[model samples]
Every structure is written in C-alpha cells, then in structure tokens.
Target: MIEINLDVVMLKRHISSKELAKRIGITQANLSILKNNKAKGIRFNTLEKICKELNCNPGDIIKRIS
Candidate 1:
C-alpha cells in the first residue's frame, strides 16, 4: 500500500492545511483530498509544485508498505 504522510509532516512543521494550501497556491478542498489520500491520481506538475513548496522530496510524503 502507498501511504500518504502529510499528517506527519504537518505535525512536524506545525503548519495548518489552510496555510499550506495558500502557500502552494492550491485550493483547500484540493489539498484536503491530497491530505486525506482520497486522490486517485496526481499530476507530476502538482507533485513538483508541492515538493517545491514543502521543501521535501516525494519520498518524504509517500511511504510504501506491504
């Protein structure tokens, strides 16, 4: 399974979803989908933008588990 780690990062950074959404130039609703791992697919462009804004790599956000 692919797990999304946004909650961990958010706790670590003490950043709110609203702040991240504003900083990333994405809507809160869209961010909620991503944060909740309800998104079926993500664009590479969006990933790049997120990584840039979050100052972290994809590995930091995604974890693979059996």
Candidate 2:
C-alpha cells in the first residue's frame, strides 16, 4: 500500500493546510482530502507543485509499505 506522509512533512515545515493550499493554488478542501488519505488519485502537476512548495521530494511525502 502507498501511504501519504504529507502531514509529517507539513509538521516538519511548520506549514498549515490553508497556507499550503494557497501557495499551491489548490482549495483547502482538496488539500484536506489528500492530507487525510482519502484521495483516490493525484495529478502529477499537483504533486510537482506540492513538492516545490514543501521543498520535499515525492518520496518524502509518499511511502510504499508492505
């Protein structure tokens, strides 16, 4: 399974969901879906924006576990 560690990275960076959403040009509601792991899929462009704003690699936010 793939687990998203977005909350962890957000905490490490001391960023709020609203703030990140604004920076990434996405709505807070959509961001919440992603953060809460309820998202069915994510767009690559959106992922790129997130990585850019959070200054993190995709691997840092998305983890594969067995």
Give each model a TM-score.
0.85, 0.96
- Per residue, candidate 1 scores C-alpha lDDT tens digits across 1-66 of 887888787777788999888987889999899989898877888878777877789889888889
Best by lDDT: 2
**lDDT score, residue 19, model 2?**
99
The backbone clash count of each candidate, in order, is 0, 0
Could you give candidate 2's per-residue lDDT for residues 1-66 as a string of tens digits?
888999999999999999999999999999999999999988999999999999999999999999
Task: Give the runs in model 2 whose Cα sits over 4 Å from its true position.
Answer: none
Best by TM-score: 2
| Candidate 1 ranges beyond 4 A from true positions | none
Candidate 1 local lDDT, residue 38: 96
